[model samples]
Target: MRGGGSKNSPLETLGENANLEISGDLISSSTTEKIFEVSTNLGNKIRLAHSSTSNGKVLKEHGYIYNVDAITGLKSITVAFEGELKLTTWYDDILNGQSVNLINNETSKLSGSDCAWFRIEALKETKIDSIKIEYTCDAKDGSFAYTSFDDLGNLDREGAKNKNVTVSLGERNFEQFEYAYDGVEANKYNQKAFVLGNTKLNKYNASVPNVGEYKFTFLNGIIKGGADVKNPDNTNNSHVFMLLPNHSDVVFENVIFDSTVSFHNEFYTNTWAYLNSLTFKNCTFNGGIFDFPAKELTITDCTFNKYINDNGQNDSNPIWVRSGAGQKGEVSLNKVTFTNNTVNAYRPVKFERLGINNNHFELTFLDNTFNMSTFNDTDLKNYGIYLDSGVTYHSFTLIDDGNVINGGNGDKVYAFNGVVDGNFPTKMGTKILDRNGNEKVIVGGKWKSIEEAKLCSSIDEVATDTNINVSSSGTAIDAIKSSFTGDNATKQSTTISLPSGNFSLKDETDRPSLKDKTVVFIGSGVNSTTYLANKSATGTEKGSDYSFDGAKLVVFKDMKISLGTANYNGFVRPQNLVFDNCLIEGMGHYWGDKTTFNNCKFSLSGADYNIYLYSGVDFTFKNCEFNSPTNRFMNAYREETSTEPIKVNITNCKFIGAEDTASAPNAKPVVNIKKYINPIWQITIKNSSLEGALNKEKGFYQAEEGSKGFVSIDGNVVWEAE
Candidate 1:
């Protein structure tokens, strides 16, 4: 009744004559080769009994059923015929998940990744070789791809005892699906078998992008788990989370996955445990990760925190990955970005792959930050890769597109690699970031640090001038040009700009107080970015001696501001300043403080750093052209005593490198960021490029701990060399 020895012929059992379960283990186990010739296109099926619970009692009316025990089951069902196969699965008692592999179907529009039920885990294998699968899905029971777990609001409410969410496809389905996790029987459904997401990517109206923060549909669901010995939370006091698959982008927003308690296998395996095309927005991870064998896993603006006094023994990471055996598949990181996420460790993501080598893992870390010194957390950090001794990743491409890393503990990483993976070289280490933040790898693994980065001194705060602003648009014009001759000084006027609206100038003393530098200036009755400038600058030389210094809010239009050498030795900072259409002629700019230069021209002939950065918050240069001559365009450093992170943005700006690579073979980077006393600089150089030669190796100096910074060279920002 079950197999095909004496009871029934294998050929007749696969036909319309026999409606009994065949023993695939019994049939494939023997070398006799009981080949059944049946037309798959004519709706033929080779049913198998459940591996557990019932020996698969539920059988289809007209198909050959085989025993589905993977331990003693048919390892593979090879169809020599090139045609469509409607792959359907049915729950057999408690056969957790069957992680099936459909090989030789590279062009197959197949389905089924890990599933809740054999019912939910169904696929139609459409082959390129004249095989077209039926584009239909038949759900049995709660076998549709969509699933949900719990509701939020209340604090400590655990859901139903049957907590597993499973769906499958078949003519027959289970009513009120009752499933249990018998941890006592460990390998029955191993602790590592927790499936967060296991279906092919689904289509929807609203989806998440690879980078940037998204307005996530918050599923305020929480789960209180049972006890486990390895968890920090065993007493059911915390609310944990496990992402349930919805066949598409389902954001687990604001939910917390408690690492206090081990949620099954926090470290992923190539089973139902892997996520496939899932998005997690604004979520928090205590244990961290649903990594390994992941397909298009997008995590945006999520906070990851993990700490264990395992006494430096556990190879745990916030997003950890390990596979003892070679996983022969593709695991692409469509977008594993962390723009606004806080990660604790120096290197939040740790991966150790010691396998036989058959994987293509291509990853690009763009526009995020890994601050703090984590290189000393483990022994592997000494090699700059933090890889275990026998680890071999031949096809691993870790691109430091733009990430800022602070420092390492053990030694200075000369050829800095991966802020995400200590193996990624010089995203921000040893070298300063490229104007656009791309780590153009030096040919050999050798690197030399830019010596100028160590020359930074702490910032000296200046006093705020209260009565420096002009009262009205017409009056502002008079105050600036009336005394603005060769000296670049105004008549007792510190900073002048048009008032926002219809300003009736009472007096210069009655202007708005810009002492706190908190107000945003906009053009009167025009776009916030555009102001009607009826007048142009009288001359193009001389950097302004009139400082926009202090945290004073000032906006300048059609003016020439100074980038002078004086007051740049950490004396004055160009804080809270905005320049539009300004001509900057001096050298050695200093102390960036929330400054934005738009449509500005930097005409300094030659100096050290065009922008001698000391300390401050941020700087942005857009639509600017620089014909400056210097060792490099910019270099920065922060003292060990400070904690404020520096951020610089140079976008849509063109720079002429001081030396050509061919002419001066030892040419260096244009933008130089320094090695710091911890807190990093979030630097983004996008839509910008250089016209001359630069060292192929040097890009940006590396950057931190809890707080993350944004580092990326996005939107075609490559340096040109001839």
Candidate 2:
């Protein structure tokens, strides 16, 4: 006989030498339910006998009796009580197809008893059907071990929809929970729906498959590093969710996430595949990064705290879409409403679309409160939206509305080193409302209300001046070039104000024509208006006469001219011209007669010379600085045989060498004069500072053997090459 007893067992000992025990295996028939009774005394053991039949004729073998035995010999057994008997068993045996109705509210006081709670192992090979479970256990406190549920178990078929199973876990707190249906096949006809509800899960990791819709509701979870079950070697312990290819929908509502989340590749080569849509509504994410690359992503009523690192390890800004060769698709952030959110990030969003053909990318920011206060790192201080460089795709658009970014450090909205001319936000200081009725303005290095700025004049009113303001509306260079020709040509004694912007002049036909015009071109400032020439004029006849024509008297003030690869002269043969507070950079030559300069600067790095005079004329320089690091200052090359020599006068002018320091011996000569048939060049330097010494013993000019020139240096300071 086999018998088991706890301290509260009802069986009693018969005598000092006789102990009572019982053992039985309950047997059942196909048609009827059987019942058994037990009756025992203090010193006697009871056991029931199996009967073959009631008569001699064998009772038609209806059902067999239950096998019963007793440690002490007994004749008959009878019931003494009327209440039902309850059984307690281990959960692990229940998972192995044990049939027992477990008591719902039983507590095991033992510390290491398997009958305390049930556990289901989510191994690679496990299958379970309809089960009801109710427990008040904590996985973190060692009450249960196998608490996580993973759907990647080895099933027989591709679709588990036929199983029709439901696991009702009631009011349990788990340390971690995982769900992944990666290998499931797509099923549009009878797609199944899995639901996990009423659980306060500490950690979560899920990847919805293509076959069905997965809904997670009322889940308060924290997903972070070291919470994942499949931790690959030599990788960060991060939580990743991939909406696999052909996935229908994954919804997360009424969930609070207190961990970092990423939606990118599983590894370097394993991308998240393709997803139709992913939606998040009414969620609070404490700190997380989103590297989502989906067809359509919708986020509404969410709060994001701290900075989010997008793709890689370095934390600068969150990259939304970086489309490359194999990652080309029509990705979009459709109808994202953060109306009840507070965002604190360095660079909030960075979108880059390259090598994507016939695909559109769109982003929309609506009704959100942004705090541009903190940064991912100290070096990444520009806390605003960062548009990646060279983001040229088929079509891209951005819709921003009702978003307030406060405490801005740098540009509130900045694009990288590329040209982005689509619907971009205006300058930060400008008062404007975005498309979604959001007031946005940057004030005192912070984003604030437009009314707080209290500007003295409106931007439109300040822009409408009486002077002829050059517009960079269309092709900037072409616009400026067109302004100098046709009926809109600059008139005499008129002020042509250049706008405060950069202009790219590429076409040769787009060069400004200032021939015979006596106009004064005023700029916003020396560093404000920049004219960048793109075409090269090397080895061309007009190389020395590029950008301008032989105007009579033109005045240029407060502007910057940048020469391209062309060895082009910025100004050519302006009879009587003046330059005031201008910066001429990368100019190959400057050929003009009777030219006067005041408070002007020149940066001629690899030029032939800073100034070249071919004819005998009066060129005066007062308070002008020339910075020619690698070339000569002045080159007087008179080819014609004339009795009149080129005359130049420099007063209070400073000539700086290419090498800024005094210890460099690479300084060039001050003046170089070529041999002429009738050499009579004259130069006067008084009250001026020359950084490098003159070329020859004549101090200011190096004339050929037969050439002659007069260089008068009076009260001038000369610096010898170190």
Per-residue C-alpha lDDT of model 1 across residues 81-191, encoded as one tens digit per residue: 232233333232223433343344332232222221221111332222211122222223322222222121111102211122222112111112111222233333322
Model 2 poorest 10 in a row by lDDT: 452-461
Q: Kindly list the per-residue Cα lDDT of model 2 for residues 1-722, writing each as its tens digit.
A: 01111111122212111111222321222222222223322222122222232232111132111222121221122211112212223322223322232222232222222333222222122111112222222222332222122432221122322221112121222234333333333511121112232111111223334434322222223333322211111113333433232333434433445544444432222233434455665555554444444455667665565554444333434324444322344433322223445566555554554325434344565666667654334544444454444443333344565566676554344334332111221111122335753332222111221111111000111111124567755344454544555676543334556778775433456466656655556666666777554344554436544444566665666667665434444555667667655676765344456676655677775555676665437777755678765536777665556566667777666777643334333434667766656656677877666664322222354555555667677744332211
Cα error, candidate 2, residue 569 (Å)? 21
- Cα deviation at 130, candidate 2, in Å, is 32
Query: Cα-based RMSD of the predictions, in order?
Result: 24.0, 26.8
Instruction: Evaluate all candidate structures by whole-model CA lDDT and list the values in order.
Output: 0.36, 0.42
For model 1, the stretches where C-alpha displacement exceeds 4 angstroms are 1-187, 190-218, 221-250, 260-275, 288-290, 311-316, 323-338, 346-348, 354-359, 371-397, 406-439, 442-722
Q: How many backbone clashes does candidate 2 have?
A: 6
